[model samples]
Target: MGPLQIKELLQQTPDGQSVTLKGWVRTKRESKNAIFIALNDGSTIHNIQAVAAPGQFSAELLLTVTTGSCLKITGQLVESQGSGQAVEVKIDDIFVYGTADVDSYPLQPKRHSLEFLREIAHLRPRTNTFSAILRIRHALAFAVHKYYNDRGFFYLHTPIITASDAEGAGEMFRVTTLDLDKLPRTDEGAINFKEDFFGREANLTVSGQLEGELGAMALSKIYTFGPTFRAENSNTTRHLAEFWMIEPEMAFFELEDNMDLAEDFIKTVITYALENCKDDLAFLENRLADEDKNKPQNERSIPLLEKLNFVVENAFERLTYTEAIDILLKSKPHKEKKFQYPVGWGIDLSSEHERYLVEKHFKKPVILTNYPREIKSFYMKLDDDGKTVRAMDVLFPGIGEIIGGSQREDNYEKLLERVHEVGIDPETIWWYLETRKFGTAPHSGFGLGFERLVLFVTGMGNIRDVIPFPRYPKSAEF
Candidate 1:
């Protein structure tokens, strides 16, 4: 009838039936009597081989067959005589939809570096590495929705443009319509945001948590999956200026219940990827293994498949932030004077400290809770001692803190006090504070950086590579 995707064709029991295939030509090899072409339609990572006899097409038509050329072919589906694939198409007719210039094309048949591929972000999807990565990314996203849906969690869509900073770090991208060349100023000489769009200062949301609490208060359990922006000037491999976050907020769930859900959620998605994305994960596993072999013996990593299985099978270590701090203070890194930021109480844990806990000491994922109130956000539930809040951070082996969440403060006065303590005006987020005043509950939630999870699952070192188009400081090209 019409065209069959290469993914579907590769799985069929070849019976020499006629079929139509449409895709880009990945590679072509010429012989005196025949020309063999590998066709890919982005339906799957595997390519289908097509054979053309001497008289099947003109010499001029044959010359157009090159990498990246789009083609439509009618052929006979027969069992392949080749080694890697199961089926091949014996072409009866061929048509070139478009042809890529071989003299100027960036993606050659040879293996290219990830850095080089990133420069050509628009075309990187056609490569085997990115193709497999994107497939796995899709699988992971599906698993996220399936896991939450199966657990009775309602998916909530919060506002992308918010008036208040949920994180309270003050690192936010302002969304304004005011002209910079000609500004409207107050009599006090400050630029008046009242003249701007929305009649008040607004920003691209750093999180959807504050609004998610309103949903959780009534719905009992709710989650958010959307894009978030940060104004941090970080250029690290683990950071992105714009990224996707999955935030799950639940009513009546404490820090312990939050940890249970987080652990289960992570394990479920990893297991789903392991079972469903076999071909893609295998390719990534092999890629990581090859890359690791080039590193020093001490810096080399375990196989990706084994690492995934390890996370699926093991129970995450749960401990208090104080306990983790104690372990770090007595750790060898501290004694040997190795850590760049020295370990002590009341100080925030650096990436080095987090990696030490998960990678070197525990050798499993860790859930650290009850962080000092000064180190955490203002919305976190205050402990009885008033010194710490019910904040939890889940740290993985390679990447440090993959999740950061807390039990939200249900008491309006305590939340207001904390807000004022953090130097944020209470009038700005009166809507969020109203939720606590009306129907308060012991609500808890966490923000999981989706790209970080993908990075961990795919064994990718750079955060930019996992996302389709990463936005970072000074780099938003394509």
Candidate 2:
């Protein structure tokens, strides 16, 4: 009955003492005289089983209560004689504050497909999958704060809406409030952005790295964990229109130091999630393990726990872009899947290339570094070799490039040249350039796609499952 964690409830110290608990109903069943209900309040992955006895709880009363109903229980804590669990609660009283209607309720007792559950996104959190996931989410978030804050990093909140293209990827979602009627026009027939919000073109941020870089210049070390939006028309399992990214920026740091921070932070989060949410991970692991034993070799019998343990215990495989190219050349003749782009020295590694490198060759998480200069963003520091940039991507087996980062160009002249090389207007980045003009120092950062990492760690097949009410193409539904 106490507002205690479900895992802790199993070893209750006050076995016969009265307690109070508030949780939503997971499942409810009834005999002729008594009622049994499973309740979870998100303190833990395991749900508490409550036994409402005859005279105290009317079975007919419980039958009226539908799924997703919020209830409070005052009861005696006792171990269950039921086959499934070693614990149960003997309910003394039940106060149903808000009961769900059976006819209008979206979540039924029957199994619902994820696609269907996504439609009713508002109510899906009451389901077991989401409830456990969000609990893990909270713990991981706390872990992030702990990891950074302990290292003297200030939490910086970057702007959601911005006037600059950080990535220069042309994947920005436009932010405009201009009048359609009597719209401003250019010298040509095309509509111009002369009259718009901020008096020019603007967009939702794709990553907080750029702004976080500005904060790092002033604050020494800072990290931004916030929502980012992209308008790229990607409908794959790994893409989301809106997602959360954690970008950490540091001053006076080189590429090696940046990689170390990234590796440590990622491992810390994995350890935190594994230590804190064992029951949830176990449930998901068992679900995936039992799923389709008759499926193909690549599909079936995946050892998620072993791979994750290896990641936690061992070092991540690190390879330069040039070395990766060598591996790709040797693999080309044997590979059945054709790559979209030619695999060569200067070409960008396609998403498929990333998947193959991490999943096939490394068989672990890989840190691929020093990418071709032309393939990366303008801000990445150009290597001494002149042909490659100080860029890196942390690619996992199932999740390709969960983190993309680089050591930024710190020299004013070179930075300006790269700015011109990328064809972005120099006038727009005047403030960013001024930061280098005044006491410049080498700096680096990475943007980690929060949902993608969660997908890999949770063993959730789709990116949408890890994110609550996932926003993708035509998916702004509640």
Candidate 3:
């Protein structure tokens, strides 16, 4: 057989079986009798011990096995005498694929801060915390596809570059190939986009929900999983310039159906991580607990595993936007002037308001619905009072709005009026507007920020820590 991965070797019975393992050396210690090495293959957080006896290899070979050294070894898997590990490899042959220069190696055996690791992102995955996070991220992604596929939702690939401003936020990154120093000008002295690559204004898509809806109109249910970009200038821990979004749109589905699916989908993904990523989650949980030791008692978050399980077991509390506003009006934070941004019926809920709803007031996940139309997008179904829309936001304890969706307006006239109200040119989104003109049904969908979900599940603080290569305001370092 080919070389066995460390994860597979660790699970098998160590009955003196010969195996070839390929991985990097995590650490090396020499005893009086033998040389002990902790080797990892990036398949699991745990490392397998490989012992090289005194005569098994030359002194030169032993000197090369340092931290970050790549190696290929053929050895016998035997029961380990070590305390933490179950199996050990008694080396027979060794090949030093690469050697790390101890003087310049960024990742040492000692603990490095997350900020320091971010600078060397190319090598950070070799660390325990990042490796575990990436593994759990993989598990969560798999569960997302599995859950949607099991429910018969067709996966749709939407265009990355689009001409329409779906969010109407106008924060899209433009996709163009034009020389700024010498640009084509129109008769009005304005730079002409007609000479550009796409022959018109185009941008990296901000959301796929608009296109996903077209697929749902025909397929009954469809979803999009891909990268989206934003040109916002915020440099907070919660913001990312580029990120992945999962949007599932369904035809003939109302706001209630959307909320139900969102809740169930989140629970299913979290449960998958709990089951398949037990070792990784356990490692992260311990890592988080260790991190909380320095924090003040009141500032420490709930235990990692307990928080995840609590979300899975409990039903999310549902309330209207008006009710939430009423609750906030009477809240101590509101009366004591603790919120930096004031809260009211017409104003959009800030992070403080959302956190209060989920963490302080309800002490659980919150599903807030019926937001004022002025505060929501133009596509949401307007209520009879014409003041609120059928929009809903799923708020978590630490992460405020993990998911936002609503039942789409099926009336062409009403939707058109909303489009005009939002100052979007009707000619630009004619295709999207046409969906309502033909056979429009009451439909709904929601967007789940994949990294934010990973952040919540892994109990990571910064959104950048959860993603592999984060693209933020002024940084795109890999």
**By TM-score, who's the top model here?**
3
Residue pairs with clashing backbones, model 2:
1-20, 1-21, 80-87
For residue 386, model 2's alpha carbon misses the true position, in angstroms, by 1.4
lDDT of 3: 0.93
Compute each candidate's TM-score over C-alphas: 0.98, 0.93, 0.98
Candidate 1 clash pair list: none
How do the residues 1-478 of candidate 1 rate in per-residue lDDT, one tens digit apiece? 5667889999999999989999988999988888899999988878999998877688899888889999999989999987998899999999999999999889989999999988999999999889888989999999999999999999999999999899888899999999999999999999999999999999999999989989999999999999999999999998999999999999999989999999999999999999988988888888888888889989888788988898899899999999999999999989999999988889999999999998889998899999999999999999999999999999988778999999999999999899889899988889889998896889899999999999999998899999999899999888
Of the candidates shown, which would achieve the greatest lDDT relative to the real structure? 3
Model 2 per-residue lDDT tens digits across residues 1-478: 4366666676676466777778888788877776788887877767888887756756566765567788888888876767887778888888897888888888878878878878888887778777777777777888888999999999999999888888898899888888877788889977688778677888999888878989999998999999999998899998999999889999988999988988888988989988888888887787677664667877663566765675777677888999999998889533644776678898877777887887778777789999999899999999998999999888876667888999999999999999999999989879888888999999999988888778877777788888888989987876
Candidate 2 displacement at residue 3 in angstroms: 4.4
* Model 1: lowest-lDDT 10 consecutive positions: 1-10
Better of 2 and 3 by lDDT: 3
lDDT of 3 at 426: 97
On a 0 to 1 TM-score scale, where does candidate 3 land against the true structure?
0.98
Name the regions of candidate 2 deviating beyond 4 angstroms: 1-8, 32-34, 55-60, 186-195, 292-294, 332-342
Give the candidate order by descending TM-score: 3, 1, 2
RMSD of each: 1.3, 2.4, 1.1
Report lDDT (CA) for all predictions.
0.92, 0.83, 0.93
